[model samples]
Target: MGVVNVTPDSFSDGGHWFDTTAAIKHGLGLEAEGADLVDVGGESTRPGASRVDEAEELRRVIPVVRGLASEGVTVSVDTMRARVAEQAVAVGAALVNDVSGGLADPDMVPVVAAAGVPFVVMHWRGFSESMNSRAVYGDVVTEVVEELRARMEAVIDGGVSPEKLVIDPGLGFAKNGVQDLALLAGLPRLGELGRPLLVAASRKRFLGHVLAGEGTPPPPARERDAATAAVSALSAHAGAWAVRVHAVRPTADAVRVARAVEGAA
Candidate 1:
């Protein structure tokens, strides 16, 4: 999966692809770069960002989703809003990549289930403005797993087929640098949820912290591509079904090589 943030405030690439034309072009580029799916998000879920209303979000994303989906690119709407998901799916999006895991909006789970498209439930708490402050956890992996387990049960009970669901650990959402590292180290544990796992560690702040602590301040987003590829390799080796990335080609290549090497071993 490759990320195409149509919002002006995404944590990593905010404002870079907010224009419809630029976003569509970027989506095509990602597809050409070997992304199986392109995730188009209208709102910025970056820590401490303000929320965008449904109308504005729709205006930003539906056309792009429709354009990409019509071109045979699998598009996932990175929204926690049910209305946006429904409209996007109707416009041709094939999946809903909800960062809030259906917690932000009351109608999201039912909407995705009713749409019968693949739904990505990312672990999160509250809105982006408040999530960073809510990062307290006693045994982060256990708590996240249990929380996701409960969410899975809710979605299943709400009528979503298990086959159409995927879980994401949300590497940087509410986690501090140490917690992010812990989640990556414990990636395989999420497999206990009995769902495919999608890891999003691309150019996140924690990786920057890691690089910076090792030497100078971490490089910028574009410069973090190699580290992102390394993270993709690690996640794929640990059995992640997919990795959400900004730089698709490198991560795609790294994952392929990692899988091939591991399989040969």
Candidate 2:
């Protein structure tokens, strides 16, 4: 999966693709770079970010999603709103990648089920503005897995087929650096849930901290792509079904290398 943030404040490459034409071009570029799917998000869910109104979000993403799908690209609408997912799928989006895992909107599961498209149910505690405060965990990995399991049950009960579900650990949604690392290390445990796993750690703040060392300022988001690629390689080796990344080429190469190594082994 490749990320195309259509909002102006997504923490990484946000303003760069805020324009409709630019966003479509970027999605096409990601497709050319070997992304299996291009995920277009209209809202900025970065820590401390405020929410965009439903109207604006719909305006921002629909054109991009329609444009990409019209061009024969596999597109996924990255939104928590059932209405947006419904419209996007009607216009040809192949999937719905909801960061809220149907927790934000009561209609999301039914929308997905009716559309008959694949859905990505990500682990999220709350909306972006207050999510940081909800980061507390006894054992981050175990807690995340348990929470995701509960979400899976809710979505399944809501009429979405289990086979159409994909789970994402949501690296920075409500997690501190340590918790993020723990989740990455615990990928196999997440896989035990019997759903395909999506690792979305592309250029996240935790990787910047890991690269910065103690007491140093972390590098900017764009500079963290190489580190993201490294994580992509490791996550693929650990059995991740897909990786959502801003820069797709390096990670695409990394996944190939990891696959080759595993096949040889």
In angstroms, the error of model 1 at 39 is 0.2
Task: Report the number of the highest-TM-score candidate.
Answer: 2
lDDT of 2 at 4: 95
Residue 109 CA displacement from its true place in model 2, Å: 1.2
Poorest stretch of ten by lDDT in candidate 2:
254-263
Candidate No. with top lDDT: 2
lDDT of 2 by residue, 145-210 (tens): 999999999999989999999999999989999999999999999999999999999999999999
**Which RMSD does model 1 reach against the true structure?**
1.2
Q: Tell me the deviation in Å of residue 140 in model 1.
A: 0.7
lDDT score, candidate 2: 0.95
lDDT of 1 by residue, 1-265 (tens): 9999998887788999988989999999999999999999999887888988889999999989988998899999999889999999999998899988888888988898889999888888778788888899999999999988988888888889999889999888888989999999998899888899999999988888877776678777677888899999999998899999999989988988988898899
